[model samples]
Target: MAASPSRRDRTLSAHHRKKQPEQVRRALLDCAAQIAAEQGASAITIQAVAERAGVTKGGLLHHFDSKQALLAAVFEDLLDKMDQEIDRTLADDPASRGRFTRAYVRACFSDRLLGDRSLWGALSVAIVSEPALRALWSAWLDGRMARHAETDGDQRLVAVRLAADGVWLADMMEKDGGLKRYPQDFEVVLLAMAEGGN
Candidate 1:
């Protein structure tokens, strides 16, 4: 039996409504990131984010109570996704220190991460505006670096860590010209260092 048009429409509409919350949340975050990327994090107000996301202010507030909370969520989201991608990248060669360093660098520079500069900008502002948030971010990076050091040792890991930070900073600042020469050259040097080159 063929389904009536009204019934088919209702079924699809119900499915859409069921999926709307997640979609709205994603939209809100995307909009917030755009605002942060375009005008810096200080410009990301709830109203502005809502407008950018094509949602009402009430709808935005329904998902996030305040700007601080939203910023926290954004940072958390970026970190969590990065962690997952790194984990997946390292899964096959867990014991290869060189592979781990390469995977880490690739993840940092990947299109997925680079495309979310707003999240980076927001995190930067959060660090200055909220000391605790900064501390947490520091702790997270320190722990990751310590793990890298444990695996790759002080010398190689130090260079890798510094390079990672430099790459991220250059990208966030849109200083591509200044950083253009480093990606290939730095990776070669870093890989050699990781492999105990002189």
Candidate 2:
């Protein structure tokens, strides 16, 4: 039997109604990121994000209890995004290679990691300004580095890892400001270094 027109409309409407809150929450997060990028942390108030997101202040509060909560959510979301990219890049490694280190290097150089400077800038600010957040970030990176470290070649692992960081930093500086890029051949040199010449 065919559904009545009003019943069909009601089913679609109900589905959209269920999605409304999630849509609003996403909008609020996007507004928060934009504010952090464009105006820095001081500008990312609940009222500001709500207005930017076309929602009431109460609507924002429903998703985030406070400004700190909101910023933490934004920071964590960016980190999750970064981790996913690193894992995805890591998955393609071959068996007979410096798998972990190469994956780490490739992950650093990925567009996923290079994405959205405003989000990166905001998270960087948070990490630098908050001691707890700084400690947490340090622990996470230290764990990754430890896992990638070669048991018999700690110095080589550190060297290649640092080279990857150097490459990532240079790339960010060039895009974030007007910092001059390294010579065009530098990335090739950096990746070769990551290969550990094995």
Candidate 3:
């Protein structure tokens, strides 16, 4: 048999072996999101994500034991980021409910500035594939709607929330040839809704 591996070789190997579970998970989720954005949510898979992230199958498994776990992580990441941005936007004017709504609309439709659309697409897939995720999203939406209602009152807030959802869904589906066709018009409507108007 050959001599034992050198100390340097062992050190280097150990360094490379470090799992960095959180980093790996983030990388895998980002990769999945990118693929989803490019080819739709149906294209996301463990093998594909591993390849995109430049990690081996075993390495990916070290971070997320299964595809379902990975998908859940993706959804959690997106929702957390969205919540952070919403908080930041609302922090500027906590007293003005209209400002909060405006910020929320801007956060959602402001292009890829928020987060990769692939992540959102992955979330869309997760919602359908996993019932728990669907429940989580529904609960989150209900909370958001309740908060909006506190500010704008019941009826108007409901309309605004529905309209905002419509806008978000339309944008996600790339319907009407994407937002370019009516970005300005949509923005106006969003602002109006935020302001509790038509």
Q: What TM-score would every model get versus the actual structure?
A: 0.67, 0.67, 0.74
Full-model lDDT for every candidate:
0.68, 0.66, 0.68
lDDT of 2: 0.66
Q: Which ten residues in a row have the lowest lDDT in candidate 1?
A: 112-121
Please tell me which predicted candidate would have the highest lDDT against the true structure.
3
Cα RMSDs of all predictions? 6.2, 6.9, 5.0
Most TM-score-accurate candidate: 3
lDDT by residue (21-127, candidate 1, tens digit) is: 98899888878867777777778899899878866788889999999877766766677787888878778664566555666766655652344454564456556
Candidate 3 per-residue C-alpha lDDT over 61-99 given as tens digits, one digit per residue, 9 for 90 to 100:
888888877777777777888888888877876456565
Least accurate 10 contiguous residues by lDDT in model 2:
176-185
Off by over 4 Å in 1: 1-20, 92-95, 111-132, 142-150, 170-174, 180-185, 196-198
Q: Quick one: ranking by TM-score, best first?
A: 3, 1, 2
- Output the lDDT of residue 75, model 1: 69
| Number of the candidate with higher lDDT, 1 or 2 | 1
Q: List the residue pairs that clash in candidate 3.
A: none
Candidate 2 has which clashing residue pairs, if any?
A: none
